[model samples]
Each structure stands twice: as C-alpha cells, then as structure tokens.
Target: MPVTDVTTDHEALTMTLTAEFAASVDRLWKAFTDPAQLERFWGPPGWPATFPRFDFAVGGRADYYMTSPRGEKAGGSWEFLEIDEPRAFAVLDSFVDAGGAPADGLPTMRVVFAFEPTAAGSKLINTTYFTSAEALEQVVAMGAVEGSTMAFNQLDRVLAGLREYSAGKGTQTEILDDTHVRITRLVEGPRHLVWRAHQEPELMRQWLLGPDGWRMSVCEIDPAVGGRYRYEWEPLEGMPGEKFGFDGETLLWEAPRRAVTTEHMTGTDFPSTLNDLTLDEEDGATLITLVIEYPDKETRDMVLATGMTDGMEASYGRLEGVLERVG
Candidate 1:
C-alpha cells in the first residue's frame, strides 16, 4: 500500500494523508498534473475516475466524475489555487452537480499536495482542510478514508506502467479484502482489439477456451446493459473433464473501456459474482483489470482455489495469438 498514514484532526478540521511511492518526485508530479495519468487511479477500485475537463495551471479548473460499477456517477471539481512545479499545488475541491455547478449544501475542501524526494523514491503529503468539524465528520462517515486508501494503492501500478508492471506477470491475482479479488493481465495489443476479443462472439470463441483440450461449445453474448450472456465449454473427445458453463447478466457496458456483469455457474445453486472488467491502453498495449466481488470470504476462496488464475493465463495467451492474427 502506498498510503503510510492517515490522520484525521477533528480539532483542526483537517485530514492528512502520507504516502510513499517508488518513483521520482518529477514522475509523481507528472502523474498528478497529467489528466490521463490522474484518471487511471483517481477513484477507488471499482469506481473509476474520468476527467472531462482538466486545466492544469493555477486559476484553472478541472471537472471529473467517478462512475460506479453499476454505471452510477458522482461528479466533482477542482479549482486550482496555487501551483509550484514538481513540488506542491493546492486546489479547492467540491462536489458538483451534473451540470458542472457546485452541488448545493455540500462541503468544499482545500487540498494541498506536497511532494518531496526521499532516499528510495518520493513522498507525498496530502492535506485536506475542511471548513468545520461537521464537514470533516461527514466525509469520514461517507468512507472517505477507506476509499482514498484504496485509490492511492492503485497509484503504484499506474506509475509502473502497464507493460512494465504486468507484461510477464501472467494473470496476477490479488486478494483485496475479504469479498473482493482483483485479476490483471497485460495484452500485447491496442485497447480496441482487446475489447473486440471480449465483445465479439466469433473472436471470443477463438480464444476464450480455458485450456488445451476444451473447446467453447456455446457462446451467446448480448453486448448491452441488462442483456444476458451464456457460455459453455465441452471437453474434446477422450478428454477427462465434464462439460461446464456460466451464465450472466450484464449490469453495465461501456464499449472499448469497461463492462460490469453478474456471473453465475449455469444450472447450479452457487451464488453469483459481480465482475467489473476494465481495459487501459498505454504504448499500444492494453491492461485488462477484472475485479470480482464475491458474496463472502468463503465464496471468494472457493472460486480462487480452483486454479482460476492458471486458466485465465492460458486463455489470455490464446487471446494474444488471436489479436495477432486479426490485427
């Protein structure tokens, strides 16, 4: 985790966060000032941030929103108040309405981002000043601390770059808390091609097969929110394993970027899991991130213990070949 400490001073009506990153101060500053880099890890795990408007200079403004897994959106804005290159900057952060106006009665805060060089890399001291104790308490009640920590933890991956971080990782799995697990892989293709490999049924059938002896016997996909998809796999002749399938309803779908769905074992009594799939492209390669939300710790463990990561690695390896042939 990048966040080392979080201190909430009720008396001073302030919240301070201290984090260290294995990146230089210049790189850290660029990550904050650059809109593309900021959006990559600004929000918590499932909720992703997008900056529609970003003016980086002092006296400018930035408008952004975080979209939830189910496609709900919460908007926020930042008014740049001060700027010192590669060192510090401050902004007035406020909740905003859909029309980009400040939301009525919501508390605004002053946030200062201070960066400094450390022996290993760099450190960030982030302080948010609230107008009153009520404002500070309100955010805490809203899970700001937990959310911020999760958001900051993602920064390390962004700083590392997709290819540098996950090229040879081969379907990395991270148990994020009890109910959530994150799976990641880097595809050696552009974002659009990677999206198509998942979206198109023909392409999916070509590469979605988990292992060598199995084939995708059925692939019925509807690429829209609230649509349903069913996929089944069957073993080749003389193979040992039995046939299995999964069915799911799409909860959210954003072409070439994100898709969220509920997945359940077909014809079984197993509980469903929410899969939030997102793709980020950098330097002609796409990073595939899938965060699965299980109903409980037991479900999470049960699903992961089945060699899921290994299967995914095989499937993704096939996907790279599919992309190469189709590109």
Candidate 2:
C-alpha cells in the first residue's frame, strides 16, 4: 500500500489528508453519499443518527448526531458542495449544536473529498479549510483530525466488504504509517477468554499495566462503527511507580471486532502513537496483533532503539498471565 500523506498549510490553517485503500473508488463513493449506508457505519454502535431525511443531490443536506453510546446527543451538519460520481465530493463541514444551530468562530469550512484510481486500490484525499490558524488549532485539539481519519477508515472497510457488508463486520483497519511498535502474541488460551480480556475494561487494565495503585478513569466503549470509546488513566496511591504517564485516547470504535485509537500520553516523554489491535481465533487459541503507528520516522526510530520489542514481550507476558488467570 502507498503511504498516507498529511500536508499542512499553517497560513490558511488547512490540512490535506491523502491515502489509498484496497477497494474500488465507486464502492467508496456510496458509503459516503448514501444515507442508509452512512448511518450504518457512520458512528460506533449507539451513535444516534438524525437524518430526518437525506438529500444526496446538489444543494441537498445531511445531518447526524453522535449520541453517547448511552444516548447523550451530539450533532453536526453537511451541505453538499459538488459531487462527481465516484470521482469527488465537496461540502461544508459545519459543527452544529443540539438544537442544530451553527456557531461563530467555528464557522463552517469547505471540505473536498477526491477519489482516484491506483494500481493497488483507490486513493482518497480530504482537504479541509478553516477561517484562521487558531481556529484550526482548536479543532485539532478538539480531536477533529483523529475523528475524521477514523471515519474515513470505516468507509474504507465498508467498501472493501460491500458484498458481505450487508451482513459482515465492516472495516478492520489499515496501517497509516510504518512508524511505531508491532507485537505478535501467540496465545495458548481459549479465544473466548482472550476476547473478554480485550473487550472488557476491568480485565484489560490489569495486564496492560502494573496493578499497583493504577486506576482507569474511563473505559467507556460503544463498540460499533461511529461509536466512541476513551481510555483515561490517573495515578493512584500506595504504589511504587516510575514517573508514569497520564493520558487518554478516544476515537471511533466498532465492536466485537474493529476500531481505531489516537493515544496521547502526558507526563512521559513519549510521542503519540495511533494504536490498532486485532484478533483472530486460530484453532482453540487467539491470535492477537497490536500495531502502534508513530507520527514520524524519528519517533519510530526512538521507540525501536529503546529495545521496545523486548519490553513488549515482557508486557505480553503480563497479558498472558491475566488471560490464563481469567480463563
């Protein structure tokens, strides 16, 4: 696969995200333009969609809400700018309130989504505009980049599995970069037990880190396309700890299977790594692969140079212990 390029224009507070996937451009088109399909994989499970009606033609409108999996409401609107079959789409991505009201400073900006055929598959380019540098920065801080990329990722998966999509679990995930860590753990335990450890928060917290005074502040997961999940950690007392990290990461999470995460750690000098974890049941055991993608080559180099592979083995040992215990 070709690389996903992210180019920024600070003066205009704009960003252009370009990437290719293993599917045809036409297939990718419908997932974005069709209302029914959009709702199907738009948010993680439980994300409330409000498209009283969907108009895909020029001058048509589409609106959606990301209700917390528990049903708390959040909304946004889109106005089609230009649509060229299987080739491109342009629109205004406006952030709207619960009452469907647009705000100032956070003005609606133009979004241009282009599709191009490639030998390997299809390429997608997302160009988004903003009014000012500060506004762009604020939106990035608000997690816009991660969210949009993740949503596009969902679209990629749905298109790839269109035949089975009508009955299959949508997209798994694709590596956006070659940076970060890669770990392949061979498990001897039953997959069901390992699956629970991955899906259940309480089981996850124990093996992923030392249980000494470690607390998980947030493990909320909706677990479906367009659903939301956040992992927040805080320090606890009565523990011997390194200058541990305090952090949180939230992004689109599809359940029982697929998801994307943007992990940001504070208090430690670690770079943000986009983490993707996948599972497959082999025989009676589970095959789990965790891939962490760093922002740049330098970050990746630093991580690898730190003997990260050995460290991961140690961590997986902890995970194995937990899985066996739970099993």
Candidate 3:
C-alpha cells in the first residue's frame, strides 16, 4: 500500500495521512488534477466514483458521487481554495445533497494535499482539518481513515497505466452525459503561453478561427471575473456560412490555470452553456481540458451536429502553430 502513516490529533482537530509513491511529483499531481484519472480511484474499493463536474482550479467546485455495489450513492462536493502546480492544493470538502449543495447538519473540512519530491519518487502529505474535536470524532466514527486508506491504495495501479492510456491522444472529445461534454487536448507548449493564447485578443485572433475558410473578425476579451468577452467569425472571401458571434461573462479567472465562462450564441434565444477550461502542465507540454455544460440534451445534440469537434480540432491544430511561433 502507498499509505505509510496515519495520525490524528484531537487537540488540533486534525487528521493526517502520508503516502509515498514510485512516481514523479508531476505524475502524481496530474493524477489528482485530471478528473478522469481522479475518478478512477477516488472512492473506496467497492464504491466507484463518478465526477460529473470537476473544475480543477481555485475558486471552482467539483461534484462527485460514489456508487456502491448495491447501487447506493454517496455524494460529495469540493470547493477548491488554493492550488500551486506540482506542489500543493487545498479544498473545502463536504457532504453534498442530490442537487450538489452542501448537506445541512454535515461537517465540512479543509483538506490540504501537499506533494514533494522524495528519494525514491514522490511523497504526499494529506491533512484534513476539522472544525472541532467533536467534528473530528464524528468523521472518525464514520470510518474516514479506513475509507481514505482504501482510496489511496488504488492510486498506484492508476499511475502505472496513465502514461500508456494518454499517450499521443490528440484533441479527444468525450460525451460525459446527456447535457455535458468534455474536450481534452495535450498541446506541446507551456501553460502560461497556452493561457495567453486564450486570453489575449491578438493571440486569440491568430488561432481561434475554426477552420481554414473562417476568419476571426472580432476578438474582444476582458480577462476578469464578471468581465465580458466577444468573438465574432466570418467566412473568407468566397467561402460558405453566415457571420456568427459568441459572447459571455467570465465566472472564474485563475491566471494561467483555469477559467469559467457563460457562453451564448450572440443572436439566438437558446440558453447559454457553461464553459469551464483548465490547463495543467507536466514536463513541457500543457494539457487543456474543457468541460461544457449545455442547457439540455436537445441543445447539446444540436451543437454537436454542427461538427463542433471537427472545428475545434482544426482550431487547435492552428493553435499549436501559434504556440510554436510565440513560444
């Protein structure tokens, strides 16, 4: 088992677990940051977790449910508080109701995950801070230590398989559910430059154009919470398709890491979709993950039918070129 030590301090109202893994810090960090990898082992042995929504950035939230063998489910939520790439992160963890809100009368704990380089590979110091001794006792009674240890034990298998699983997969899209889709791309570029390509209007204009025949006519961005951004596109001289634009307000903006926005088709009555974008860099390449939540299943199908993924792939192909020149 990876977990080497566990301790509880009643006076300090805290519990800590230390685990060592035969993987680099970056590998371990990606195991936690990537929702697809995280869900693989987040639950105990019998309970498999499904993270329907995971915005892995500061000021974001992750809603997940673990389903038991008997089909019973336990829901939980995490509000990300702090994130330091390849080093540490902290979150407020709580029991959540079906609607994903924190359940009443439930205790919330501040959990910090610290990653460090060790002689063999890497070490993880996971500490959970409870509000009081009573709260700590409540969790202990509920088998927190045993459950957490079981969850941690599964990480090694996941780490062992991740490289082969993700290698050379370029701009892939997965339908998460009826109304949600996740798109991921591993770009050969640094994180900050990738983020700037999305934020800066000049950089955006160079690559956000969907396909060869499309041109970005307008690219206005306000990179702040509650600020608005607008992108308009038109076909090149003799190409087909009408002029179209999209505008949205930023919901969360954590520099060079993550951003959430509400996107709307500029001239349509269709409901807006929530776009959550996150970037994580390991080695020299950055992994870009975008989770889009549509208003409903009908809207999702309609959008996908328009060859959205193909267009995005084309844009990302151009983006790599832009990154090459800028980088």
Q: Which candidate has the top score in lDDT?
A: 1
Model 3 scores a TM of 0.58
lDDT of 1 by residue, 1-327 (tens): 899999999998999999999999999999999999998999999999999899988899999999998889999999999999989999999999999998997899999999999998999999999999999999999889999999999999888888787756789999989999999999899999999999999999999998789999999998788899999999999999999999999998888899999999999999999999999999999999999999999999998999999999999999999999999
* Candidate 3 residue lDDT tens string, 67-133: 6533467999899999999899999999988878888877999999999999999999999999989
lDDT (C-alpha, whole model) for all candidates: 0.94, 0.63, 0.85
Error of 2 at 98 (Å): 1.6
Candidate 1 residues lying further than 4 Å off, grouped into runs, are none
Q: Which stretches of candidate 3 lie over 4 Å from their true place?
A: 1-104, 107-164
Which ranges of candidate 2 are over 4 A from the true structure?
1-3, 43-50, 162-327
Candidates 1 and 2, the one with greater lDDT? 1
How far residue 3's Cα lies from its native spot in candidate 1, in Å, is: 1.3
Per-candidate TM equals: 0.98, 0.49, 0.58
Better-scoring candidate (lDDT), 1 or 3: 1
- Candidate with maximal TM-score: 1
> What's the distance in Å from true for residue 107, model 1?
1.1
